[model samples]
Target: MKTQKAIYQSSLPSNTRNKLVLRRTRKRFNPKIFINRTIETTAIVSLLFTGFTGAGAMGCWGMEIAMSSRNWQHQKNICLGMMLVSFSGFLGSALIGASFSIQRDKF
Candidate 1:
């Protein structure tokens, strides 16, 4: 079996045998890409949260409708609040994503 160094060196030309192999440099942190990724993640998470809370609110409202008691009012209110908050977050993130796309296109 060939050694790892010998396998790698076998592919190079004879003229380059004495030259040093330069490794690729690491990329610098880009804030624009980071911000775009963050916005995309936030949008997806908020959309999922909104869907869950909206379903909960619907379920609570359904229970309230089927039962004669008003015990689900507080829970329904909480669900509605959470749903609204998550929906707003989703919208805000979506808007930010759109703005970023527009900015990228402009340059």
Candidate 2:
């Protein structure tokens, strides 16, 4: 059986080696695609966070209403604040996505 090093050492022709080098060198970074994907990912994550926080806020509000407790009221306020922040994040990401889509169409 051929050893791994021996197999690896079996040299290719110069043309094939040059082709491989050229292929490696041809890769390029695309900022537009990268930014679009990043915005999309942020939008998705923030939307999820908004959903979760909104649910928590509703639950706290319901408990405060049912129990008439000041502690629950405070917790409900905090949950509402978190939900609002996450919602804002989702909105910002959505705006960025929309702007990017428009820019792409223009170009």
Candidate 3:
């Protein structure tokens, strides 16, 4: 019981009775880690692309249903907008990915 108490006290860093220091592997700080993590832009852009594409798909589906009912006039504009946005999002993602690839290759 005394040994157990002594061990417990030693485990505490601030304990004055039996001193024990817990050492951990220290990783050197790197500026690159901060810069790399701070601007995680790819995820945001990918999510934007996903949302735009999903909205576009919904718009196209709406247009299809509207056309079937012969109410195509109003849906035409919306559907077109959706398709355009979807196309742009897909194009943008592709371009961004390509640009990154090119940059990696260049250096």
- lDDT tens string, model 3, 21-95? 334444667875554443346445645765765566576567768567545544555655665665565576567
Residue 47 in candidate 3, Cα distance off native in Å: 11
Model 1 TM-score, 2 decimals: 0.74
Candidate 3 to truth, TM: 0.37
Q: Which lDDT value does model 3 have at 65? A: 83
TM-score of each: 0.74, 0.70, 0.37
- Local distance difference test values of all predictions, in order: 0.84, 0.79, 0.57
Q: Show how many residue pairs clash in every candidate, following the order shown.
A: 0, 0, 0
How would you order the candidates by TM-score, starting with the best? 1, 2, 3
* lDDT for position 66 in model 3: 59
